[model samples]
Target: MEKSRGMLPRLFFFVSRPVRGTRGPARSTHVGAAGAFMSGGAGKRTAGPGRQGSRSALASVRAGAARVELERDDEMNCETRDSGVVAAGRAMTVLLDPGTGGAEANYPTRPITLVLGAAPGSGADILARALLPDIAAEVGQRLAIDYQPGASGNIGAARVARARPDGHTVLLSTRSASLHKVMYPYMDYDFARDLKPIAMVATMPIVVVMGNHVAANDMLDAMELARFNPGRYVCASVGVGTTNHVLCEILQASAGMRMQHIPYQSSAAALNDVVAGLVDFLFTPLSAALPHIKSRRVCAVAVTSQLRIDEIPDVPTIEEIGFSEAGADDWYALMAPTGTAPRIVARLNRALNAVLANRDVRQRLARLGYMAPG
Candidate 1:
């Protein structure tokens, strides 16, 4: 596997939040102002005019960090952005404590913990593992990976949101982290209100795959077979309301067909079931399914990206197959607790971009079927 290298270009930064009715990958919006100054009173200061200095300090720190990230981005020539994946220019949110102005010089006083919302061998996990050694070298500390997978990423996200707002602890999350609010409304933490976006990671397309035993040659054939036997085929997803599950729903809605939906706790488990023929087909991330597809354990029916992936050249895209609504990509990101100091956020962002700039890292991510900006 070490010899396997991707032929795709490089990936940069694009941090974005999900919006209603938006198509393609999510877009980045500046949340610096909202996070820069503490929000208690609306446009009014309750603690007299002394708070003005703190606000000003926050602004200065944010500006400095943004400049650093910009310089690093320019050094890497990070102009090429992939539409299928989220990329960003300025990836840090500004939130600073007036007293911690010089503390960033000594950031990551201890080992850092990168929390993953999915199980091992998942796309996000693969990304984190690939980047950890370089990131640890940049931050001058050992990086530890803590997996807290469950509840469609809500479990791990909530844990990160509640962690101390220090650089030592951060979350490496995916699109599912953004969707938990709507899927599990009764959750403990509010993702948008609690966590801060640090930097954009890699993005890969979702794929429609089937076991070898299935009688379908391609996506169109699979859909036709399902149409002939409605509700006879089973579709699998990591969990209900996950990006993959949503893709399953979209495929069915756009194709005007039905398949039994099976939800699992992890992408590996769901995909394993698909390979074992327990489940008929599945909508999964390319990172998880790539090895299986290469091994011929399962057949890729279609991809949910706007373009075809080099890893699987023969597989048709959902758009070409007339299921445009089902075409979408998944992204990974670095995030921290909301109150983390702006300088720390900026430091991490710089480290993340630096890692992405590495040729080996980019190639490894590409092998996972992630698209590079053209």
Candidate 2:
């Protein structure tokens, strides 16, 4: 039940039975089966004594659905949209009940491909590696990670968007992908139209790190230098439209400075350049920059969060340095191709939530500077 805490209230599944006089493959309107099984917010259903209990549960579900519909219009930000429940569940009608001999009971007929938009050492990749072992155990199959890092995660996103929707291929998306619409107007694939939201898994803050050779000691000093000598300094990002790039833009805007923006295919490569002093600085996840910061290869100028993190307690937050506008947290979510079956999505959601519930898994994420949702 704890594993299903934040998931079941929004995810709905239906068991279809033939009505007495209905024609075609139309399902019964009873709603009892779904309510009875999903009660108590548990992933599995328990048998109820009568239909009365089911009816009451159905009413609650409908009410929740209506509230979600209303909230959908209010979700104007990228992070809010990523965590939306009912709006993402417009396709819930296709959710088949596993109790009725549906294919969801025996899902993952083959190995699943988890497509990541960044390289192996990136935040998305780190979270995936931390959780995949437990998720694979729950789902009864291996989840092969396919890294296609490039174009600020667009290349990997496009591959998953076009992949077959049988649930065998899913994208491990980040908040960065959601901004692609504004960043690249003419992108080949539509993120909202082409991808299905499964669940928002975790979130973490970005760190502003600089190479050892940089003349400045902190973010304010670096900004002053860049402000005085325009375009003399350089910053790097995974790609132009990524969260890294967006944060870079925010820092420059907030400080009223200019620095050349260099884009890379992966965070590891970008951080490497920063370490080698080929680039002056970059905005990266703490997990990616923590090692370098520890080794003193790169100095953590500031964190993009309201408060400082324990791992880097000495580093001040951007807000602490008077750049409140630049403070933001990065998040990760699971998504499949648009047409992926709802039943399959439900199965994956259950598996994912179960993995997130483990205390060890939560601790591992904490060490990586990520917080898993309850």
TM-score of 1: 0.73
lDDT tens digits, residues 260-359, model 1?
Answer: 6766777789778777778888888898889999999999989877688888989988777765545667766678887887778767766777777788
Please provide, for model 2 over 1-374, each residue's C-alpha lDDT reduced to its tens digit, 9 standing for 90 to 100. Answer: 01211221222222222112221123312112221111122112223233244355455644543121111121111121122222332421112234433236668998999999888888888888888889889899999999998867888999998999999999988766664554456888887678887766777778989888888878778877876665567777766556656567545543445566666776788888888778888888888888888888889999876667877789998777775555666767788898877667767776776787788888888877886765
Clashing pairs in 2: 37-45
Tell me model 1's lDDT, rounded to 2 decimals.
0.64
Off by over 4 Å in 2: 1-103
Distance (Å) between predicted and true CA of 325, model 1? 0.9
Model 1 residue pairs with clashes? 13-87, 13-88, 14-87, 14-88, 95-342
lDDT values for all models: 0.64, 0.65
Model 2 weakest 10-residue run by lDDT = 68-77
Q: Please report the TM-score between candidate 2 and the true structure.
A: 0.73
